[model samples]
Target: MSFRALLWALGLLVAALFAASLLIGPAGLSPSDSLAALIAGRGEAAALVMREIRLPRAILGALVGASLGLSGAALQGYLRNPLAEPGLIGVSSSAALGAVIALQTGLAGAFALALPLMALAGALIAVLILLGLAGPRGGALTLILAGIALSALAGALTSLVLNLSPNPYAAAEIVFWMMGSLTDRSFTHVWLALPLTLIGWALILPLVRGLDALTLGEDAAAALGVRLARLRVTLVVGVAACVGAGVAVAGAIGFVGLIVPHLLRPLVGARPGRLLPASALGGAALLLAADIAVRLIVPERDLKLGVLTAIVGAPLFLHLIYKTRAAQ
Candidate 1:
């Protein structure tokens, strides 16, 4: 399909899935009632369920998914690495570590916003540390190494907190939060994550020309006036903002970034510039579909979004690795 057609198709799919996410739920209301409740706030009970429960969840599913997808595409394009993903920069793990700390110290319990706030703080700190470690002259290899080290350290600290937790309830909370879900979310999360996500999008969307040039190699791109250093800084900070805000509100919804960009790349003719927006739409649709499936697959079980994504993504990731090896 042409690029325009691909975008149109993806946009329609996202719209459909978003509607499904808003309408399908345990409430089992008719589609008409759901729409009415959502639009007009009719039917007090249905309105409450629609407005207070499903609406925010649907909005977040789309927002978080788009962020992850956009971030992944940007990272892959900038790093020129198929395996690159949003989490590669350690922001997600660092954010998770921050949330875990808040829970462990009862800060999350005492203050409703503490968990997400701390998580955002952790992500910001990780970016600063990553920049420091990568340094001004650092290349992709150096950035990768720095990110890996930061991710490892943050993950280890999170494990340590879980291991030493005295309160079972707190530990349980931490564990579930890490697993990731859209359950019981509110507009507070919607508002909290929106501005940063938009800013990240702004930061990333303009790098299309740079990303396209980089496909020809770093030296060639620089010779073409791509300003490699500026591109790197923008990409890193943008991914941090997107991933940080996402993990802050939704925990760690793994694989949306990895899977969406990878799936849509071939369709975009392997062009990084085209892949970015397509991946964003694809990611939003995939996550919304996944969220809806969670509601339908086991209404009582309350399945975690992260677990489902991992189950689907891990095998595919391994297959990608195998394919890469064979090609090499």
Candidate 2:
């Protein structure tokens, strides 16, 4: 399909999924009721459920999803590595570790906004540290190795916190919180994430031109006037803000970034600039669909979003690895 057609399809899909998210919930509000409540606050309980419960959840799904997708496309474009992603590269894990620390220390309980803030801090630290270790112009192998080490260390630290929790409840809370969900979220979560996410988007969108140039290789791109330093800084900050805020609010919803871009890349063409927006819309749709499925799949159990994505993403990731090796 043409780029315009692809975008149109993605927009329609996102819109459909967004509507599905609003209409299908435990509340069972009719489509008209959900739309009315969301738009005008017409019916009280419908308004409460739509505004306080569903609206934020849907909004976060779209916002977080778009962030993940855009970040993934950017990372892959810059690194020239298809495997580059927040979850795969340890950024999300590092951010999750930060949030876990906040939870274990009871800071999250004491301060409503502390969770995502700490998570964002953790992500910032990870980005800084990773860039320092790998250098601004590191190769794909260097980045992957550095990312592996960071992910391992962050995972260990997260485990240590859970294992050494003061009590079972603390450990349980940490464990469950890490599983990721959008349930019971409110406008507060949206406020916490949206501004940071929008800023991140602003940071990333401009890099698309650089990213397209980058496909011709770094030296060529540099010769073509893409400033390498600016590209690196922009990419790092953009991914960190989006991924950190996402982990903060949704608690480490893995694989959306990894999966969405890969699936939509062919539709949008190889240019990373084109892939960026296409992947963003695709991610929003995929995530919203997953969120809706979670409600329908196990209404009583409250299945975690991370689990569902992992179940699907892991095998697909392995297949990608296998295909990569085969190609080599």
Candidate 3:
């Protein structure tokens, strides 16, 4: 199918999934009932369920998914590596650690915005360290290795904090949050992350052209009038904001950013410029679907969204590794 056709199809699918999300919750409202409740504006239980729970969750899912997708695409384009991802490179892990600290220290309890703010700070720190380690003119191998090292360091720090927390309950809570789930999310979360996510999108959306230029090689991009250093700074900031806010709200959900971009790249003709928007839409759809699936798959248990995504993503990673080895 053509890129336009795939985009249209994916858009329709997202709409359909959104409707399902509204109507197919544990309380079980039919489409007709949901529509009636929405239209009547009465004190109906179905309306309350639709409005208070499912609607906010679905919207938040879309926002989080879009943020991850866009950031992933930008990172891959900027680094010129298909394997590049925000979480894999330590951005999301560091952000999660910051959020965990905020939560454990009671700062987040005092102020709702503390979590996202702290997470953003952590993300920026990780990005700066990664860039400093990679240095200018660093090759793909150096960057990847530096990212891996950063990720390990962040993971160790996160583990240490969780272990040393005085309250076992808080430590347990940190484990659950680190696993990444959208269950019990409310409008408060939506309000906290939405503004920052939107701002990040605005900053990154204009960089698609620069990404496209970089694909021809950074030196070639410079020749084509792309200011390499400035663009890199913008990309890093954009990814930090989006990924940080997302991790703050959703915890450490992995692989959506990595998987969504690559899955849509083929349909979008493998062009970074075209892939960006498509990946955003596709990511929203993918995560919404995954969230819904998590609820439905084990309704009693309430499976985490990240676990489901990891189950799907790990095999794909293995396949990629195999392909890389074969090519070598």
Candidate 4:
């Protein structure tokens, strides 16, 4: 299929899934009632649920998924490594660490924006550390190794924080948040994450040509006037912003980045440039579907969004590793 056609299809799919996300929930309101509530904004409980709860959740699902998907495609393209993803690089974990610190210090309670601000800070630090370890002119292997180290260290610190927590309730809340969910989210989260996510997209969308050139190898791309170091810095910062902002509000929703790009790569003919937009749409659709399923499957238990994504993504990840090993 043509790229335009693929985009159209994915767009339609996202729209449908988005509508499903908004309409499906435990409230059991009729579709007409839900739409009416959303549009008319009556002073009723149904209207409150429709406007305040489901709308924000749906918006967040799309934005967060798009960020992860776009970030994954960009990383895989520049790094030329199919295994590259935001969470795997410690971006999400580091962001979560920042939010955790805010919560632990009671700054989040005191300040409305503390959580997201700290999360963004954490993501920036992770990227800085990654650049320091990898250095200029580092190969894909070097970058991946540095990312692995960062992930491990950040994860260890997060665990230590959990272990030493003074408040059991706060610790439990942290654990639940880390599991990742869209439950009880509001417009506040939507607003908090929107600006940074859009800025990240702006930073990344212009790099398609660079990414396309990169497939020809770094030297060839440099020969084509692609500023290799600048590209790396921009991509890393964009990933940090996108992933950090999303994780700040939604907690750590893993594997959307890892899964979406891989699934759509074949359709995009492995062109990193085309893959970026396609992955974004696919990611949004997949996440919206997952969020809807969270409501449908064991609705009483309130299944976490990350849990379902992991259930699907973990096996695919292992298979990719096996395939990579065989290719090596």
- Whole-model Cα lDDT per candidate? 0.82, 0.84, 0.80, 0.85
The per-residue C-alpha lDDT of model 1 at residue 232 equals 81
Which is better, 2 or 4, measured by TM-score?
4
Clashes of each: 0, 0, 0, 0
lDDT of 1 by residue, 1-328 (tens): 9999999999999999999898888779999999999899999999999999999999999999998899888877876767666565676789888878877888988995677667767877886776677663445556667777887888788878977899665555554545578988999889877877888899999999999988888788899999988888888778777777788788877778789998998899999998999998988898898898889998898888977888888788777768866876
- For model 2, residues 17-72, the per-residue Cα lDDT tens digits are 98888888877788888889989999898999988888788999999888888888
Q: lDDT: which is higher, 2 or 4? A: 4
lDDT of 3 by residue, 1-328 (tens): 9878888998898798877777667876667888777677555787777777778888888888888888888877776666667777788889988888887788999998998988888888988877777664445567668778877777777777877888776666555555677777888899989877887888888997888888788789999999988987887788888888988989878788889888988888888987888888877888898898988899888788888878887787667657756776
lDDT by residue for model 4 (1-328), tens: 9899999999999999999998998899899999999999864999999999999999999999899899888878876777777777777888888878877888988996787788888888987776676564445567777778877777677767766788766555555545578888999999988988998888887899999998887789999999988998898888888888888898888788889999999998889999989988988898899999999998888788989988988898888878977886
Question: Cα deviation of 22 in candidate 2 (Å)?
Answer: 0.8
Would you estimate the TM-scores of all the predictions? 0.88, 0.92, 0.92, 0.93
Instruction: Name the weakest run of 10 consecutive residues (lDDT summed) in model 3.
Output: 134-143
Q: RMSD to native for every prediction?
A: 3.1, 2.2, 2.1, 2.0
Candidate 3 TM-score over all chains jointly: 0.92
Q: Rank the candidates by TM-score, best first.
A: 4, 3, 2, 1
lDDT for predicted candidate 1 compared with the true structure: 0.82
Rank ordering of all candidates by lDDT, starting from the highest: 4, 2, 1, 3
Candidate 4: Cα lDDT at 313: 85
